[model samples]
Target: MESEQALESEAEQGERLGWWHHSHPTFAGITGFFAGMLFVTALPGAFAGLLRLLLDYETAEKLFPFVLLALALPIAMLVKRKTRRFAQFMFVGMVVTALVVLGVASLVLYFMVDA
Candidate 1:
């Protein structure tokens, strides 16, 4: 009986530490939103690279954002741990900035290549 109680307590402790806990109320929302934004922003570059390597546009498009999301999720989690509530705003800002920079760079690169 004691061992069972101990095990249950340990499980609760683990739950408290997880991102979904009340203490980290914003963690999931922020992480998910940022991860999505990051994935979408990087999708074009990832797709292009994958397409170049595999010459399979369909596969590349499908896998590109999954890979990007995998990469972005950890980063967002790290930020959430470090900065808590501010992490959400920071993540959103960072994603927007990245998208803007990527968009501008791609346009420039396209023009340069065309010229």
Candidate 2:
């Protein structure tokens, strides 16, 4: 029985429900990086470790990463819907983290080869 204006206001309120809605974009991006680091990376790593402990180590090392990836999607979807533009920010964070790690690893390898 809500009017059109009531529905519009409800939509607006829904959009504004989360704390990140009014914050700066850079802060949101940082929030996403921390979120992705803890939620996406660290969490999965812990799960993999537990799986390795519970199951065969080599099999868990190989399979649990994909299992974590599959499990993370639902949680990420919930986060994306709840936060503003968070999925984009989180993906950026993940990619940047990956690139930085790869760069450091390659540099280490190059230095080792040089020495």
The TM-score obtained by model 2 is: 0.61
The alpha-carbon lDDT assigned to residue 6 of candidate 2 equals 98
Model 2 / residue 13 / CA error / Å: 18
lDDT values of the candidates?
0.66, 0.71
What is the alpha-carbon RMSD of candidate 2 to the true structure?
7.2
Please give, for residues 8-73, the per-residue lDDT of candidate 2 as tens digits: 998898778854656556776777777665665687778888888888978887776575465456
Error of 2 at 55 (Å): 1.1
Q: How displaced is residue 66 in candidate 1, in Å?
A: 14
lDDT of 2 at 50: 84
